[model samples]
Target: MKRIVAGGFFLLSGVLLYLGVHLAAAMYLPHITGWSTPPGKYGTALRETGGYAANLFSILLMIGGSLILLIELYFPHAAATYKKALAERNREYEKKHNLRE
Candidate 1:
């Protein structure tokens, strides 16, 4: 079950990351095509701002996907460690309260 979930996360993250890269490329397409020059200040500002926004979104998506993949891969061990720590803390709390069972 855990393997399946992790595999799904890996697949989803890979697709998201790929899409982000494609979107980023699209954000730069106009510049690469030598047609980036705008007719007016407003046009230039709009174009630049739009491109930056798109690129920013793409970068965020890529980062989010990568983090998801990493988390999915490491979650099992992390969860186990957290559970152990929680149990230890609970035990300490109970001891302090003189409520051992």
Candidate 2:
């Protein structure tokens, strides 16, 4: 069950990261054209501003998604570390209480 949940998190993180990358690429297309404005033929000032806003949002999405993915990937190691610490604590408690098996 835990494995399944972790797998789901991994899948979701991968999907979000993939989408963020694609969106960032799309947002870059306008800058690459040397147009210095929005890419539409009927582009207006408002449209240009909106385009810039969308690009900013995409960048934010990319950063956030990558961070989340990094956390998801590191979760297992974190869990292991926590478990090791807990076991060590338990051993210390047993030794203090003279309850060692």
Candidate 3:
């Protein structure tokens, strides 16, 4: 449906946004670090010219975004699984509270 497509687009947009940020960072992250300098500060951003931080940031952001998008894609099923687990724990809690095996 339209809603599903819209949601898919949103997830895709996140991926594209991450890539764009990474690409832009690759192009100019050095300037920001240079401006922020004492001399050895922003260590990770220094050695390889900020590529490390940019790549690391990109990877972490990508992973987190992908995980969120994946969960969003499976939202109803994800919610069901969570609810099932919670209900099981609740049942255990109630049984323990009642001192019933």
lDDT of each prediction vs. the true structure? 0.62, 0.60, 0.61
Across 1-101, the per-residue lDDT of candidate 2 in tens digits comes to: 45446555555655665565456556655554344444443243224434555545655655665566567678878999999999999999999999976
Model 2 lDDT, full chain set: 0.60
**Relative to the unseen true structure, what is the Cα RMSD of model 1?**
6.9
Best by TM-score: 2
Write down the TM-score of every candidate.
Answer: 0.39, 0.47, 0.35
In Å, residue 56's CA in model 1 sits off its true spot by 11
Rank list by TM-score: 2, 1, 3
Q: Which candidate has the top score in lDDT? A: 1
- Which scores better on TM-score, 1 or 3? 1
List candidate 2 stretches off by more than 4 Å. 1-49, 99-101
lDDT of 3 by residue, 7-99 (tens): 566556656765765565556545554443453434433444545555466566556656666666678788999999999999999898996
